[model samples]
Target chain A: MERQPVQRISKRALTLWRIYGGIQFSILLLISIGLVVATVLWEWPWWITAVAAALLLIDAVVFIWIVPGLRWKRWRYEVTEQDIDLQYGIFIITRTLVPMVRVQHVDTEQGPLLRKFKLSTISISTAATIHKIPALDEREAERLRQSISSLARVAEDDV
Target chain B: MYEPKRLHPISSVINFVKTLKDAALPLLLVFVLNGNIFSGDVDWIPLLIWIGVLFLVLISGVIRWLRFSYWMEEGELRIEYGFIFRKKRYIPVDRIQSLDFSEGIFHRPLNLVKVSVETAGSTGSQNAEAELTAIRREEAKELETLIFQEKSGYVSTGEEADDADIEAAQSPREKVYGMDMKDIVLMAITSGGAGVVLSGVIAFFSQIMDNLPIGKIYDEILDWIQIGVLVVAFTAFVVLLIAYAISIVLTIFRYANFAVYLEADDLIITRGWLEKKQMTIPINRIQGIRIDENLIRQPMGYASVTLISAGGSVLKNDEHQLRMLPMIKKNEIQKVLKMILSDYQMVDEFKQPPSRSKYRYMIRHSWLGFLAAVPVSIFFFPYGLLSISAGIFLVFLGGMAYRDAGWNAYDTQLTLRSRIIIKQTYLMKKHRVQAASGIQTLFQKRADLSSVKLTLTSGGGAAVAQCHYLEEKDVSHILNWYLSSRREEKPAES
Candidate 1:
């Protein structure tokens, strides 16, 4: 039997993800400060305290400067006859594949942050793990859901 | 046909009494702790309080005994229970995974048995989905037979028909495999005592440390001991390790009589020393099978088989699934696998995805443990250097663990192999997998990678057999295989 060629899907909303990174970086900065304060309260060495502070600064810089740029560069997905493929990476390129036949269920969720941005996250669950694609517009997420469900139903075998 | 019968009305009261008895040890410990804290002298008030609580509990037990009622109607098992807020649970006969009948030495003379019915639903409740505290042995057997017949898709014939089915089902007791005295001895000899002793030592030291003054005195003693303490501590650690090994061996010997047997379609594992336990796992609901060989077992040519099921709420220490076979010869693996999967071939080796450097990402990410450990360990331990050394060891192990994790797939079969100290390889078939998911974190997207995880439903729970950080192409290929199979037109057979 002839097998159909695999197709790729665009993982848009990379721009929105860059914004999320800034928020996360701010949270990390607060956490780093908390750690430093905890170390002082515990009467640990002052140098160790300095190290914690330095680490926090480094983390903050990565999130604000490097992370947004990296997010913009990475994030895309594709669909083929047999499976769904997602590829994203800034420095270290990584790809993940999910076979349609193995999909147990699919869900679409919108957080307050994403809702404000008019975006939704598409979640696909298999037996062992759950996968998600973040920051898609409602129309795009709906379309993806319908296509994936139809594909999953088509691939299901009578065992 | 054996018709369903109601349990004796007093069964619920008996169940409540059993629960109270089980709680006695903990309750006593709590009372002792409270007495110590209060430093009371000849406290009659505490004794009076205990008496009052016991009297209340006895009254509640009696009320429950009067309220509980259960009966089998058609193919459904109905249980009505509760004292103030009455609750009823209706279970379909087919949904019953196993109907276990157990009788303790005390109950044996009375001809009473405890019937525990395990179901697949996860209600997050410890109470057996359905339990009859005390029933006649014959009646329990009759109920078990009826449930089994219903699960097997056979029509129930009232009492007479049921008798015939029971006769057919009852295989010779001699044919069943059970632990003898010798087997228990061997198990004890092989199971080292190191784990038990180490846990005990840790617990003892932690208790001592908790009570000790942590201010200046503790620091002075720790500092004075630090120079020569590492060597002495190391020697003491080694001795404790040896003691642990011996204890494990003793424990295994005590439990050596362990044996598993096939009774019809059920797998029965019976073992224990002072307190004996017999657990049964039904074959049909078994989701996945795992074969494990520790360094000792591997050399001994023995392997343990665990069955991942959907219903077992309790997790075994050795493995997550129900241990169907504690110890069996390696050669017997294929035969046992065949019994589980009659039609499928046992694939020993299969093609795995080409190595991806993404593993390095996992290794790097694991250093985050050191991030948490460094601060906490330094504050808690007076021997800060030793704590730091332990943290380094953790980071090294974490990196190796990430690198050791790998996945392989062939046709409709996939196997995930991982190891740190103990090796575990999960084998699953495509049809057995209930779900598949692909995930991409913000960082993974930048790395051009996504993680894929596959799950299979087992007896009482689900087993995630394979997880990997794979290239997008490979992930798509696997996903396509799963999706394409779903499209194929075929008659459904369950």
Candidate 2:
């Protein structure tokens, strides 16, 4: 029951998250631009055009600048012989625990972007839910996976 | 050993009806396209197309019915089915968590039942491993008894499979509890879903009313109700009336013939109107018991009791397994629980957080309520002071939540008490807690308060319960308990 220090996910996750958010904003911006063009072609109301332009500006500022850093700071996890603890949420600050004995499977996934950065995401699955530790170093992810699996095995045997 | 036995021949007729109904939209689409191709000319193509599709559908249904067969072999239900590509399934009898029987409207008159076999492995809505359609009620009952009785080691082999054994197995059971008309009525009146169902009914009717384009009927009704506040009041009253009526009827239909029987180690619950559903959960499979008191029912001294069973799928809520005794009196809860679950003890002494916890709960609750009321009150003008009253009311409710929130640990069990309008006390095995977590936001970190979440496994899935805004030390104690101790075995009587 000795408390282990909660570890923050890699700082590089911030950049990754920002890039992902920017990509999402870009999609919204394109829709806004389309609306502007439609408004001009159809001679739409001035208020409608004003609202669309304002929304586009807000989206760019918030998604590109604010959210990722907040998210990166929020994402923290702790793994021990007993359980996996996660704390993350923007407004409500949700905390979750995944007991080792309940752990069914574990996988280290690396998408194209993550692979380029030498980062892997370790996903832990239980009977009811799945938990993830994103943007870990590849070797670290593998070592954690191994340790978790063995710990899970020991816990399962204990039960 | 694998001599397959087909389901009742009526299964073909059932499948035929099912397939034709399923094919309705496609047939209409084909007819429309055929009309388009011929430009409304008398080509007789649609009639030919309909006949062809009907013949194909009927043939497929018949083929599937003919192919589908299940047999008992080596303690497993081996099923071979499918029309073109043969599919086979083997389900070990012990792996089966529940065997549910539902008599559909058509099957009811024919004395047939649809048996849905569920295992611990399936989690989603389409989780039934195998569904046997159109079996005689007697055969279904016999199958149920054999699977359960043999499972309990009452019989070792299939050699004792005589007709009389099945009949003897069907002997009356001791009814532990049964729902009467009164209980159903109370449950219906206090239910929270009435408003939701009423809104749904209103929305559906409104959609149809909008489509009618019958001009003055709507206007005439609106005129009769008058404008302004009276309209709002009238509408609210009507909605409540309709909602309660619907709720009462739905509750009656759902709880009709509701009864629970204790048969050896299994607790069998059967209910439903047109579809009579039977669910069996072994006593040892239960993980936790929960008692809930609603804002409406609590004042009346009524509460509901439900179990967190490990492997049985509770069909009440898609996510929550509400194996709930709908309208049991709060005072009677302890007695009833003690008799049924055996080891159940209603904990009285609970440790409450300091009065400091009130600031967080009240402020957090009232702040949102105030903000929400602001817009409406400002827009409406004269009734603006009502927001102030609402804000105070919210704070009062929040105070109650803070006051009542408590936790207690004893022997091998832990109890958490919390209120979400409805007061709930969760009693779960302390050692059975699978996971634990604590959350502290920036402010809460400084305040030395954390919300602790404990995850426990139910029969079907993991159920999580949270104790919010407890002192930080308590959270650590809970986390520590998860690792440090060895649990004593439950008492023999249980």
Candidate 3:
């Protein structure tokens, strides 16, 4: 296989992803509590509460504990003068190459959550597709965006 | 040309007819909803209201045609239109890409054409910037010449310059390809149009059932079936045959007199019998070429070629315009393609995937069907066990897909062929590809297999061409082939 892109996304992305997972787990916990209350009030079957509890446990383990770490390890990207190379995905590893000439624009976006963590997502757009490197340090994202835009200006082609 | 010109008076009639066609389905439903007029059970109040609405629509069409005016002013195509809103749209001549002309039955009789103004700014929009419902053919040609001169910034110095303009307008177009009646018939017969028509018929019946008294119909059908189930089945068979015949006739009408012509830098396609259409696609706008061979067409040695183009909203509205060669003998594609796009080459020899990948292809295609079959068999018991045949059929299809999956890189061109029911082969240039990717699943990584995918811009969106489950080396080879383009161009430019 070809060598994977060298640069990795910010390590803080793992914590951000885990926090997102925590929010989802909290929602599931609320639903499980509701199921337990229903089992008591309506005298419903006990298995329903048991199933909800098992689902909440699995959700906590998979989303909050496992997926974020593996995803952080898998994500890598490298931007050169000639092209942008991205290696991402957990189970199905995908590596993409977008030539500099085809880069239409680059944008750095930050949501309220990401802003609080001092992180931003940089998206590189071509005429055909958009590739996003999520959760980069705010300053690093700005630097990369400027460099990519300059490189893209140097290389020109028709759509 | 500076003066605002009104279209031929026939435009009002054409506009009325066009509006009527758009509202035909709703009008039909309205008529059917009322009691049968033939049985003298018609509701007069709704009928009167419908007549009043029709009159209003007719008046609006006339007003719209009367208000619409177009002129060339200050290097822009200026159009002022609308009855109530009074909108004025000025499209710069430089932004105008091409002008498409089509003729409906009404326009044909009046010797008029409907001109659509295509602009690059209208890329993702569904409609063109402007349209002239009906204009004299000669007038349309003159307008095209005027716009061309304005775009090229040509100043007419004298009568000699005007003479040259006339000469250029009369330049001969080389006929690249044309479909004869026999091939059109063959294409119509082999097309999957019957299935579409069958589904449409089913949908129409279901819609009618929702509005009408279905219980009464059910009682009548059940009574008929009680007499003889064979009779009911025979009637259904006849309905299917009729639907198939209707679809065949529709296809023949749509594709009749299809011909391709090569203008200076444009591929001009003119097709249709009753409602004629003419589309002009710039040569440079074409990103790649795709050849499709459906199961039936492949066995019959026939295929269709579709041009993957990057611009033109005219193509976005009617995708049929993208089908440069709607139907042709498989062997004739090369001869015809050479006349049009000589840079692209059709490679016969391709590096196929290893034999070991066959089982992977089979599993990829049939796994979902097998999973579904297990649940179905458990639920329906003996009857649902028959669903296993579907999984077996899918496995057979997967074997076909594997047999056909192959890729070849020649010079700057890359051809990737794969199948998912209809076999598609994409011929893309190195520079035309916007992005490329190589994907490997966890299981495939252990097996040292990867899939190569490339994207080409087509009509404001990306068209992806992929070949699944190939050797790791072959996948890298394709990726390297794409990556090498930058290095090769850098030295050449320096």
Best by TM-score: 3
Restricted to chain B, the TM-score per model reads: 0.74, 0.79, 0.90
TM-score of each: 0.71, 0.78, 0.92
Among the numbered candidates, top lDDT falls to: 3
Write the candidate numbers in order of decreasing DockQ.
Answer: 3, 2, 1
- Per-residue lDDT over B1-494 for candidate 1, one digit per residue giving the tens place of the 0 to 100 score: 23335565556557557768987866665565444545554457777777788788878777776776777677778888787798988888766767665555445567777777776553122323777777887777777776777767786756535466778866643224454565455445555456667777777567656756778666687676766578868867886867766776656643555666677666766655433445676555455676666657667777666777655433322241276666667677677666544543445563343365435534554566567667777787665545555556655654544555566667666666654444466766666666565555656556655556666665334666544455656665666565555446332333
Comparing 1 and 2 on DockQ, the stronger one: 2
User: What lDDT tens digits, residue by residue, belong to model 3 across residues B1-494?
Assistant: 67899988888887888899999999988998887889999999999999999999899988988899998888888999999899998888887778999998888888999998876532223433788889999888877887888778884433233756767765589999999999999999988999989888888867766887767778797675677588757867887898999999998999999999999888999999999999988787788999999989999899999999876568878878899999998899999999999988988998999998999999999999999999999999998999999999999999999999999998889999999889999999888888999999999899999999999988778899999999989999999888885665531211
Stretches of candidate 3 off by over 4 Å are: A154-158, B12-20, B23-53, B121-128, B156-161, B208-229, B372-385, B490-494
lDDT of 2 by residue, B53-102 (tens): 79887888788889999877777778889977899888878777667777
- lDDT for every model? 0.61, 0.74, 0.87
Q: Which candidate would rank higher by DockQ, 1 or 3?
A: 3
Residue range A91-121, candidate 3, lDDT tens digits = 9999899998888889999999899899999
Q: Write the per-residue lDDT of candidate 2 for residues A71-126, one digit (tens) a residue.
A: 87888788877668777876566666666766767889999988877889999876
DockQ per candidate: 0.18, 0.28, 0.56
Q: Where is model 3 chain B poorest over a 10-residue stretch in terms of lDDT? A: B119-128
Each candidate: RMSD:
6.9, 6.1, 3.2
